[model samples]
Target: MINIEWKQPELILLDQTKLPTDIHYIRCTDWRQVAEAIKMLRVRGAPAIGVAAGYGLILAATEATQSNHPFSEQLSQFYEFAEELKETRPTAINLAWAVDRVLTLVKASISDNAITNGEALINLITKEAEEIHREDIALNHAMAKAGATLFEGQSNIRMLTHCNAGALATGGLGTALGVIRELHANGQLERVYADETRPLLQGARLTALELHEDGIPVTLQTDNMAAYAMQQGLIDAIIVGADRITTKGDVANKIGTYGLAVLAKHHNIPFYVAAPYSTFDFTLQDGKDIPIEMRMAEEVWNFHGIQTAPSDIGILNPAFDVTPHELVTAIITEQGVLKPDYEASIAELQSKVQK
Candidate 1:
């Protein structure tokens, strides 16, 4: 299921905000519509956000070409557009990573005097954006197989996952869900327990639906039931996708991830976070420094406008929470699995990228 697609001149997104039941799609011929889709969670997930952002820039380029604007002015517009899309999601490092990826090519072209027209800029950026989309899918496949190796020799594996980290959350199979698919394919996994993530129910609404649609066995449960499930020894391992990972290996993921990691430690279950290297912010030293996105009070206040609480109730809904590296058993990547002493492991990963 290609959650995000670029059909040249326009960006089409699977409107995840209305998923499972509706199965709707949104077509954005303009960059602002794409940005709005991102802010509204009509298109979401870290990897998906990055991919969508790339296409958003492509859409901006398309519009710029039609406006008869000079190349210099259009390039400046692209820089401005990149910042606007990046600002749509503060927590996900990939949003900026992806947007900058295209801009780097554009910048390089400018330095070489290789591009003088808007059409040339469009060609360069569109190619890079398409490649980003392809690379994301390949990364998902590689990390899925790499992460699944950790559960080798185990049979009838029961895994617990939070939020929506499946295909709906990524450009391809998924990050965490990609590994789950591999395990299922190898006949090692028996079931997945999806947390009904509060405020949005991304788990129940997206993850569960995505898994079920893929023919994987999934059990939907409320967020609060996770502890009891762990106590009953129903969960074998926990794997999730990250929004941002610091060089120290602290992961910022869905708001409930920190509590799940704590539960995994108490039960001595191996906790895993599956993400591509692009999710890592080498600049940031710790998760505490990672910006957490504070969502609307209306989300916590009601169920899609149907009030569940008193009018004007005090609410603090943080979109993400930081999970310390110590709680994580391993960080799975396309290069390989990263073990503890994560600062050093991350340095090694960075070196490979630099090479």
Candidate 2:
């Protein structure tokens, strides 16, 4: 279940697009190949994408090193490669965050003359990428512990989730799914109601697959069924993973997440978001400023390459949507579960990370 793997000079990614039906792997030896994989959804999820981008930079450095070109030329080429990787996906802040972190390290290495040759730079970048991968796993475990506390003294808690935020979606255990795993491990989880997220069905195809393989009880339902399930008292809580979180604690996640949050609030069910600190985009004042990625209409008009609608029909396929902070009962991170007065809480969490 290793979604993204870095084996020395190459990156191996599980082909997420062919999950449940076909198990396949895509090997990336070049940075452009890595970029294409991200664009094609061969490897996705916010944290996973960031980890892939870090390895992509390492691959770029490897190519630059082998060229035997002038140091200035190599550096310029690597920066261009970084920009290319950045453009692969705009909505997931983790992609840009991971790329920038590696770029920053590269620049610092050059300034201090710590990496004079391309070989040395490649080594340094690779180490950083590995560290990013390792830290994600640690963060996931910490977040799971913090999130599990919310269900203390409550047994057999039934939860609802959107999209595929599991081990396949990250470098570690997962974000939202990690919380679910922790609860299951503690014998507090009864079952999971997974939304068959449309246009892609990541929940049905990925989340359910992952949960089933792990022997976790899962019941898949169409996205529209979420509210009805809530009304029926089938769901005790709603937990989702975020691609981006604004300073005010507004969340940008899978497209149907906003609706789920609204339903949760109306039903008096707690709505929670789980993510690492890197998912936070503090520079943005709120969700309004966070960019939303619009995917191709073909994704909606066709199902597994079979036409589901008239080819000429108009379609809007936004990959994500924002949920206002008021609807979120808490935000779970490696630090702890952040409660309201989010602006202050977020700032406090960010400052601690800085220290």
Candidate 3:
């Protein structure tokens, strides 16, 4: 099921914060609501957030009128909207990448005098945002096929995944989950182990729900049980989606991904990261430079708004963590599976970069 949809005049989002129980959809007629949803985790996941941010820019553009301000002034307003949305989620590179993509395209069009007024500007942005949504769906499928090939000939393939990298998250089949779907479709999948990502439970609440709804056999386990499960030979491989990937192949994903990678290495299982081209951050040479967003302390100290620990307890709640390139088996992308020397593999990807 598609979690995010554009029904005109409103961007209908399947409120993820209320998942695994109520399938609620929140409508955003204004860009700020979309930005708030990203910040609130009401509409989350890297690709989903990127897709939402694109639509958010459209909403922001729709608010401006050529009669009220000059074209330059309207462009400035659009830039401000883009910056505000980008700030809502700092760890996910897709947020900034998608926003900058749309903005860059519109600016180039205007520079060539193709966009002469507010109406034209809005129309161009609408098409670009819609295209971003469509492209993400296609990328999901492409990456799935590329990633699934790695597990070919291995029947009853058992897989482990963290966070919510399913249709609900990616606006398409998924990244890691898409690969799982492909395996299931090929009659090769035995079972999937999903980690119940803490402080948010995106895996338990979102991944489990999606996999169950799709009739895929899924076994939910707490984040701490991952190593035990691996030691018991309950997991064959670890696959996850990335928030940001650096040029060195270091991955920034959900907070617990690094630990899982370490466990997978010990178990001699493949540790794969699935992501789209847009998720790559070319500016950062190393994952250490990738800014990790520190979340509110209450996210770790409380459960559903009820205090689960001392009220004054100190908490270091980082939303994401980095997995060094040495632990990664390969980086799955739409073009193909990237194997080390990532510099060489990523060269092919960098060739396709526009920005």
Candidate 4:
């Protein structure tokens, strides 16, 4: 379930757009191709996108190094690749976080004169990219463990989730879904309800597929049915993955996630957001500052080239929406779950990391 694979000078991505039926891989030999895959949703999910972007930088550096360009020129090309990859998806903070991390490492290496040769620079970049990938996997596992603790002493926990945050979405198990997997492993999970996320249907096509393959009991419901499901007491809790979590604990996730959080609040169901620390955007004080990506109108008006709505009609297709901090019961990360007073809690966790 490795969605993004780096085989040195080449990157392979699972074609997410054609899932649940056709399994295909898109091979990218250059950074531009990787950027295109991100834009086209070939490699999606916040963590997955970040991992892909890291490898994309490696491809760019490899190409520049193979050209025998000056170290400064190669460095310039790395920045260019970073800019292009960063622009692929606006909602996911992990994309920028990962790119900046690798770029900063390269800059530090140059400043310290630790990388004098092109090959050495390429090797360093590749190693860093691999580290990002490996760390994402480990973080997902840690997040699973931390999140599962919330369900301690509870059995047959029925969880509802939005979008697809499974192995296909990360380098390892997943985020929110990883928690569900842990619950299932412990025999504490009763069933999982997946929302058929509109326009893309990642939950229906990807999430359901992943859970089914893993032999986890799952039920598929349309996005609008969540409220009814909650009313029926079919849902014990709501857990989802985040694209961006601001310093104040506000979250931006798939477009329907905000609505789900609202419903969870009204229904008195706990809402949890699971993600790696990289998904946190410390600079953004609130979710309002997190930019939302608006996708093409055809995604709503048309399905697989078949018109579902009148052509030329107005459509507002935002790829993500923000949920206020108060609506979130907890924010689960690899470190641990952060409770209320999130500004202080998040800062404390980040400081621990810095130390």
Candidate 5:
């Protein structure tokens, strides 16, 4: 196993929007700046966003103390800031989870009266931020092991994946891509087929880059090629990550995921969703309840400042699409591999963890 450390502080992030060329990292200081960076996708990926959100709260708390704000005032400001940060991206539940955790930490510090110095409050929040990062790394390992079981005894697997679901998406390994990585590490993987994932092209850019760098066998194909690949027996399984999984086991992921699920159904291949438990949303009963984030039309009309379509043409680009639980063969989380009966399995897992 390779020991992975967080990127250098100076290299904050490699601006995913400008990949393949112009690899640049933007430096950040203070929490609001980090939140803005995250909103702009200067720093992104589900796990990375969560990690950054933790740091953002720390930065806000530190700034409040420096300004000599009263504890009551700081608390009010912190909640408002946290809410704003949570709204930056709607699909990824980890962003909200991270912010809420940090808010709890801030509240505890103020109520505990264990630290008399205001500076100590800042230090405490920073510690929690680091813990969030550390915990994510541990969770990734657990999720990978549990998810890998889906491929057990299945050799020469030709797995097809969508978007950037590898280490770039999670803390260290990944969700869907992590299982593929585990298979490759064990020499069970034959090849990984990546969907170009239109518009954003996370698969062609990030997924392709990470797999190639790790010496994993991979090929990039357009979103439409998935069905053809499966038809030709080029795909043995379909593995992908999720932005959110409802209580009913319906999954909301990259915009094209629903289509892929339909294709998987026709091909009679097993479709698996790999994600941490944090991605689960018990509040949503089914896919219909998951909020679909509609992005700006400029994303579709413009390609890197070049006009891809006419300015007068209207476009509706949704950040994510939902896949019904019926289309999913299994849902992999740190707790274990769950069948489509998520309501029962998730409730069971939550009860155990809460205990």
Candidate 6:
């Protein structure tokens, strides 16, 4: 079964925090539930979060349909709810794009007598949301193949990755981790050194589990162990997935990605970011314009309600960090690999998709 799917109460999402040991599902029927899930990382990944928001719209529409509301009234209410959902997480463009896509579809589909059959609208909304999920999975596969070719002629490539950018992170397959999967399938992968991302441990909790389940050889290490591993000549390349990319080619990913980018530059190892074109934000000229989300401070001070640090101490938890364009060797997208002048290349890809 897919991790997130449309079901009765609303949308069914696999709680990612409870993965590897327990598979739990949270049924959400409203935008508040969707916002909470995104904020808590219960439903995560750039692509997956977007999909969740799209489904959230459908769920909200179901309520409107049941109330026997007119199509215009229902759509206005749903659009407002989707806008609120979009603001819950600022780092992922997929969330904004997905919500906007659904609203736009609703506006175009409605007419003077659109409410003639609310049931039909619900079915169409469900179909569009499913398409979002299906398309993301297909994109992951195509990008993985294109990215794996960049590591050609290099046998036994020892890779180091941070956070959970695997099938769990995307609708299916992954972004940067998808390339790692492709390499393993082609017999070029030797080992994967996964960083146990602190505060949340997404790497240890999610990435490691996904890779292990896939029968890939993976080792989990603390975030501090990355530079040490590179210095020991144990790493060949560094790969990561992005939450957002600016027109200037700056990247924003998990909090620890900036440090890894610096270490890769020092070690003279190539660092690559793999993502779909939806990740690129041509509106932002540089990383400075990208808003970094300051998460709840309690995440750093406690784990599952047990205090790990002094209770009164203050903690600043930024969900993501920016990686300079210079540190990234290249970016792998579904269309193909793109270079630093990502502004033009991203525009070209968007143009093609639009046509």
Which candidate has the top score in TM-score?
A: 2
Cα lDDT tens digits, model 3, 1-355, are: 5689988889999888888788888999999999999999998889999999999888888875534888789778878878888899999999999899998998899889999888898889889999999999999999999998898789988899999888887878999999999889989999999999998999999999989988999999999999999999989899999999998999999999999999998889999999999999988879899999999998888878788898797899999999999999999999999999997788779897553
Model 6 segments more than 4 A misplaced: 111-117
Q: Score residue 303 of candidate 2 by CA lDDT.
A: 85
TM for every model, in the order presented, reads: 0.98, 0.99, 0.98, 0.98, 0.93, 0.95
Over 59-113, each residue of candidate 4 has an lDDT whose tens digit, in order, gives 8887766766777887787678678778889999889988999989988988999
Question: CA RMSD for every model?
Answer: 1.0, 0.8, 1.2, 1.0, 2.5, 1.8
After TM-score superposition, the amount by which residue 238's alpha carbon in candidate 2 deviates from its true location, in angstroms, is: 0.3
List candidate 2 stretches off by more than 4 Å: none
Candidate 1's residue-wise lDDT over 1-355, tens digit each?
5678888667889888887788788889999999999899999899998999988998888776676677788778778877887799899999999988888888988999998888888888888889999999999999999998898799999999999888898899999999999999999999999999998999999999989988999999999999999999999999999999999999999999999999999999999999998999999998899999999988987887699987677899999999999999999999999998999999999998757
> Candidate 2 on 183-248: residue-level lDDT in tens?
999999999999999989999999999999999999999999998999999999999999999999
lDDT of 5 at 145: 86
For candidate 5, the per-residue lDDT at 250 reads 90
Residue-level lDDT for 247 in candidate 4? 88
The candidate with the higher lDDT, 2 or 5, is 2
The residue-by-residue lDDT of candidate 5 on 1-355, one tens digit each, is 1212233232154577777565766655556667777776666666778877877776676666665667667667767777887888887878887888777766776689755555776677677778888887787888888877877787898999998877777667888888888888888899999999988788997889889989998999999888889989999999999888887889989889999899999989999998887787766777888788888888888878899899887698888899998999998888889994778887876676557
Task: Provide the overall lDDT of each model, using Cα atoms, as 2-decimal numbers.
Answer: 0.91, 0.93, 0.90, 0.91, 0.79, 0.86
TM-score of 1: 0.98
Angstrom error of the Cα, residue 230, model 4: value is 0.6
Where does candidate 4 stray beyond 4 Å? Answer: none
lDDT of model 3 at residue 107?
80
| Candidate 5 residue pairs in backbone clash | none
What is residue 83's positional error in candidate 3, in angstroms?
A: 1.1
